[model samples]
Target: MLTAQATSTAVSATDIAISLGLLVAVYAVLGLLWLFLVVREISHGPAPAPAGVVEEETLPLPSAGPLLRPAGGPMAGSGR
Candidate 1:
């Protein structure tokens, strides 16, 4: 009977250890989940817009100003 009681106690202790281990594992998983959620929330914040610098727009057509016009062309200023 003593041996049987000793065996029961040893089995109960192992059971308790396993239970505590499972509890610790559960808490660890929950902690990781919380951390992941926080990181995800931070990452989800609006992404920074392409640097606030403004770009200048260029014209597709060539300038028709006097200096830019061909020297001997009619568009050189004397329309005649």
Candidate 2:
């Protein structure tokens, strides 16, 4: 009877250990999947800019214009 009880306890301990090992393995797989996704995204080039936006190199520089004025209001140099 004592030997049977010892055997049962040993089996229970082994089952607990196996369950813990399986849990760790599952978490490891999930972590690996997340790492793969991150690496895949990084490997791909950056996403395209939204519509109606011009690249910095293609943008035109500001041209000289009348100094200061609220649109159609008195100009800065001209007295109000």
Candidate 3:
């Protein structure tokens, strides 16, 4: 539909460039805002896991013993 009023006005190249520039600027601002919120939340850190899931009695650790041989075992260096 051609309206007499609409046909009379002309759009310029500068107007189109400005519109695109403004669109990019708006998107950039939104991206930066999203990044900032993400960084702030990451700085706050992960939430602590629920304590109820894990409950165990602490037992004394087993004492360390010889790595390889018992007292009666044959020595490793001896030719067999």
Candidate 4:
């Protein structure tokens, strides 16, 4: 009876090990599939530049306001 019980326990342990092995294999296959999809996306082309490549001379900006006020204030046209 003792030997039979030991044999049954060994078979149960082997079954558990096989189940765990199959689970690991399934997860590995899923991970590989995800990696292949991500690689396919990155293999298309180069990404856009972080800084713009346009020249400032080609597109001049507007000038800022002058230091003096307009010619219609309380101190305007008085020459003071």
Which candidate comes out best when scored by lDDT? 2
Q: For model 3, state the Cα shift of residue 28 in Å.
A: 1.3
lDDT of 1 by residue, 7-41 (tens): 65445777988999999999999999999999998
* Residue-level lDDT tens digits of model 2 in 1-80: 67755665545777988999999999999999999999999999689999998899998756745653456655654555
In model 1, pairs of residues that clash are none
Tens-digit lDDT string for candidate 3 (15-78): 8789999999999999999999999999999786597654345554447545356556665556
Q: Relative to the true structure, how large is the alpha-carbon lDDT of every model? A: 0.76, 0.80, 0.75, 0.75
Name the runs in model 4 displaced over 4 angstroms: 1-11, 45-80
Ranking by lDDT: 2, 1, 3, 4
Question: What's the ranking of the predictions by TM-score, best on top?
Answer: 2, 3, 1, 4
Off by over 4 Å in 3: 1-11, 51-80
lDDT for 37 in candidate 1 is 96
Tens-place lDDT per residue, model 4, 1-80, is: 68756675545777988999999999999999999988987897666546877655777655644425566855576775
What total of clashing residue pairs does each candidate reach? 0, 0, 0, 0
Higher-ranked by TM-score: 1 or 3: 3
Q: What clash pairs does model 2 have? A: none
In order of appearance, the predictions have TM-scores of 0.41, 0.47, 0.45, 0.40
Query: What is the Å distance of residue 30 in model 3 from its true position?
Result: 0.8
